[model samples]
Target: MRAAEIRLPGVAPVVVDREVPRAGDGEVVVEVVAAPVTPLDVLCAGGKSYFGVPRTPYVPGVQGVGTVDGRLVWFPTSAGMEPGDGSMAGAAVARRSDLVELPDGVDPVLVAAAGLSAVAAHMAMTWRGELVAGEQVVVLGAGGVVGQAAVQLARLAGARRVVAAARSAEARTRAAAAGADAVVALDTSDHMELVGRFLAACDGAADLVLDPLFGVPAAAAAHTLRAGGRMVTLGASAGRTCPLDAAVLYGRSLRLLGYTNKELTGAQQGEAVGVVAGAVARGELVVAHEVVELGEVTGAWERQEAGVVRGRVVLVP
Candidate 1:
């Protein structure tokens, strides 16, 4: 089996020939078809994330769609957070509990590229954000794959209005095309200016905020929330530390909730995957991505790490 692995921390993964991983008891050996380069994979290989330092010479894929004994499925890897290799290979050993089998008609590569990210956005709006029909939504970082999924999911979840904020003109255009009722171009360098523009675009009010950019965008979106509104933060794409006015936070009686794919129980994760994959199957959701071969993992990996790519990168093995 040829696998892309990181031999040490703070290094890029390299493709090497290695023995195929064997499944232990209660686990399954999956023949990988498509694996997406995700932030979790990048952060873990860096040896510094909530996942902590990873063991050297481990595979660097967090999730992938594959076939377990001929049944197609998706599985997540916490190798960066644990002691194990992952699915960036010809085959992988996955826990039975973590597998989400796909329907027969679905595209495994598209699911691999879009499923997990869609789950993050879908869960943020429905479960953690507690968004309801007739409520207004503001999606920050609405350009990345997750962000694009969020803009559509927010509308599908019954939001009366959906406003998208992104830094690039292309991103903002993509956001609008993805179903954001309105789009705001957030100035990457000016935090306060970004906040002001978001508020203006949203008409100074919103009921729910699905934030992926935690630093400047988060703080700016905070001020636009209506009194007693809620915000669910899922990632820190722009920056980690966000400054918030105590008065705005306290006086408005707002709620700030944090969510991540790691927090969901196995059953919940599986259920979310089903919903997301079903939406894709029905054309309710679609993800833009570039397909790269296994040998080109280095370039795809670098694209993900640079944080410049606006679409999902699926590695087909």
Candidate 2:
């Protein structure tokens, strides 16, 4: 078997030749079909992500679609991140319970794209965010995998309107295609004005904000909300800390919630994967994918790290 490993931080992954191991009890060895390179994976590669830095020389992929014992399957949690190998390899071991059976009609490329983004979006919106149907939602950083997925999932979850915020025309178009009611670029001098514009488009105040970019965007989304609105922060792409006004939240009775898939139980992960897979199978949720050969994994990682790629980039091993 061949695998890609992050030999060190701030560098490209190094390909290493190794032998594939057999599956143990309660485990299934998945023949890697496709895996997506995500921002989190990039951060992990650079040793800058909030998740404690992983050991060097370890495979680094969070999720992948594969086949286990002739059954089409995908695993959400990265065995690679937990002191074991990952989907960057030709084969990887997955816990039997953690393996999700992909629907016969779902494409492996799409499943690879959906990967972690779909599960996280589904989990954050339904379980942690308590999203309500007919409520307005503002998705920050609504261009990346998770952001785009959040926009689509919010619509599928029955939100009345979805507002997507990004900084490029291409990103805005992609968000619109994914199902945003309105798209706004966030590079203007006055972001507060932009928030007002989003609220105006929504016909009033927003009810929910699916925020991945914290700091300025979080503050902007906070102000865009109606009384008693909620903003969920799953990623701090902008920065970790932000200047928040207690009075603003207190006066509006607004709530700020933070979420991460790491905190979820196994059953919770299963539920999220099930919902996202079913949605993808039914054609209700679309997963955009860009496939690259396993030999190109290093270049794919560099491109993703440089933010030069659009949609989800999947590695076919």
lDDT of each prediction vs. the true structure?
Answer: 0.86, 0.80
Q: Candidate 1 residues 1-317, lDDT tens each?
A: 99998898878788999998877899989899999988778888897676688889898888899987788898887777788998899998888988988878888877887868899999998999998999999999888888899988887888889999888888888898889888988866676787778777885589999999888788888888999999999988778888887898999999999998878888999999998888777777887788999999988888889986668888988
As a TM-score, model 1 comes out at 0.94
The positional error of residue 150 in candidate 2, measured at the CA in angstroms, is 1.1
In model 1, the worst 10-residue window by lDDT is 187-196
Task: List model 2 lDDT by residue over 1-317, tens digit each.
Answer: 88888887768787788788578899888898888888778776676655556677777787888888788898854533556667788988778888878888787878788867878888888788899888888898888788888998999889988998887788777888888888877776365676576666665788888888887767766777888888889988776876566777999999889998889898888778878888788887775568888888888888888889878889887
Going through the candidates in the order shown, the clash numbers are 0, 0
Supply the TM-score for candidate 2.
0.93
Residue-level error in angstroms, candidate 1, position 267: 0.8
